[model samples]
Target: MSDFMEKLRHLIKGGEGCIDHMYLDTVAKVTVGVGNMLPNVAAAQALPFLLRDSGSSASPSEIAQDFESVTEQEPAKVASRYKQYTQLYLPEGAIDDLLDRRIEGFERRLRDDFPDYDGYPESVRLALMDMVFNLGNRGLITKFPSLTRAVRENDWAECAAQCRRRGIADSRNEEVRNLFLMALG
Candidate 1:
């Protein structure tokens, strides 16, 4: 992975760490591994079976095995698993591959979705990806229209201001906005 992607992955991992067994997220969905959401687990593999479902039982060994396998799997499969499950349990194992694929995919999508994307600074690109990773593309696109416009115009100050106006804590907003400025310079 590129240096930029590595940095983004570290930031994402800061927010979404690895968990081996199945657990419930804020909305009560089954979550396992690193941020993998359970309902969509099938998309990860040819035999994408849930170690534990919302209403199913899973032994400790079974859960351990599921988590271990994720770590043991190849990079592509690991990324595929994460995308399908939303959480990938083994950070030590497949994180690099997962980050590479996820970041590259996001960059490609950004370029495709925005005509002005190619001219944006690398930091802006990274910030945009971070937003999508945290808030989803729809949230970035819909929740922060001014931020989107500012990004399109390469108006880093306005982008930072828009980021600061978010409902998230000031510290986090400041951190992200600072990242934008760092990229701008």
Candidate 2:
């Protein structure tokens, strides 16, 4: 991975803790492996989930059972608590792969929206990627028109002012703001 990707991976993992087991996110979505949401049973089944005890590959039925087990539990519990609902886990390497795939997919969407994405300074790129990671492509694009306009116009200070997200920690917001500010220097 490039240095930027390595740094981004660390940043995202820190923000979204890596959980091998499926759990309900704050919004009750079935999520695993650094905030990866499995929207349906088929999405969960498509991954290579392993038996937590034996580390053997899980059968489809076992995966489905585990998925259902997790879904039945109360929503918004701690991620570790959800482990009790299933005997399945995603291996660490698989988690990394999933994160990589998500980053690549988001990058594609970002490039589509910002044709100059690749040419931006490292700090600008990092801030934008982190924003895209937190807010989906459409969310960032549609919700934050001022921030997108600032970015397209290379107005780093404006970007910093407009990038704050709801429900995110203030520290994370500051970090993104600082990244944009860094681009100013």
Candidate 3:
């Protein structure tokens, strides 16, 4: 991964640090390892390392069933019942591996779906990747035709403004816009 990609992950994963276990995020998703969202118990199959460290001899299908057994609840409620209800755990490097996979998927989507992505500035690419990391898809960028066009034209200012116009607050949007400007400078 590029330095910019690391920086993007740092910015977005802010204060969360490197998580080494699975838990319920604020919105009730079974978030595991780092920011990997486990949409279903079957999703756990992707992290064999974590499963091995979970200390359970349960097969993948059994683990998926366990994951499915947890009721969808808020973070606090999940935390309260965590010890009694969940058995997910991650050893060192498991979270990193999962994050790497997620990042690779996002990069692939960015390269294949975004026109001229290879030719865009590093900052612009990183910003889009950051957005993809958060949104879990490149479709959000496609929703803003002006932003994509501005990026393709290498119009940093317009791209920044378009980022803000997407209803993101100025403070948060400025950080991303400034990244684009930094590359232009």
Candidate 4:
């Protein structure tokens, strides 16, 4: 259900202009999933595009100052808050890790389907890997027919259109759109 949760978060976050976020020291940055270029980007800029239509009441500097002092809230208090929040609000992304093997399953399935296009470009690979990571082997297998056809013919527009047809809402569709756009560039 992790994929489902990811899609749900995408919906909740308004989807557009979405970027992964992380804190680096006292600064914030947009995560490229592997890199961070804008280290000093304000929290207001770095935070994920959640459903908050209102702007920040405090300035970015003020927000950073508050975060700096946040440790004083006490370990137990913080722990309690975490428990309460998790129980009432936050998503629990904990996994079993029971079913994770070498992923020979994916390789076998991909070969059987998209026999051509033995590999993908780095950007395209990132997009495909993300979709597979989120959705798993079975999920990828389900879309084998259309995705395989697109890759075999090297029709990226059709491939992206196929991507848009699958996944919850347009969750994976955005990835396809961005991936093909970058591939063209």
Best candidate according to TM-score = 2
> Which residue runs does candidate 2 get wrong by more than 4 Å?
none
Each prediction's TM-score against the native?
Answer: 0.66, 0.94, 0.70, 0.38
- Residues 1-185 of candidate 1 have per-residue lDDT tens digits of 56866677776666555554344555545454446554543433322234333423444454444544444444423233434432323334443554566667767777766778867776777667777766766777888899988887788888877875444556656667887888667
Taking all chains together, the TM-score of candidate 3 against the true structure is: 0.70
Per-residue CA lDDT of model 4 for 1-185, tens digit only, reads 55533443343233322223222211232121112223333633333222212532344554344333332333323122322211111111211111122223444565565564346554454445445544555676575567656667766666666655443446556855677556555
For the record, the alpha-carbon RMSD of candidate 1 to the native fold, in angstroms, is 9.1
Where model 1 places Cα greater than 4 Å from the true spot, the runs are 40-91, 164-170
Model 1 Cα shift for residue 130 (angstroms): 1.1
Question: Candidates ranked by TM-score, best first?
Answer: 2, 3, 1, 4
Which model, 3 or 4, shows the larger TM-score? 3
Residues 1-185 of candidate 3: C-alpha lDDT, one tens digit per residue:
67866776676555234554456766777766556777876677666533444465446765565466554444735333543445555665666667777878888877776768878887888777666665556565667678777876888878777765344455556777777777687
TM value for model 4: 0.38
User: For model 4, what is the C-alpha lDDT against the true structure?
Assistant: 0.40
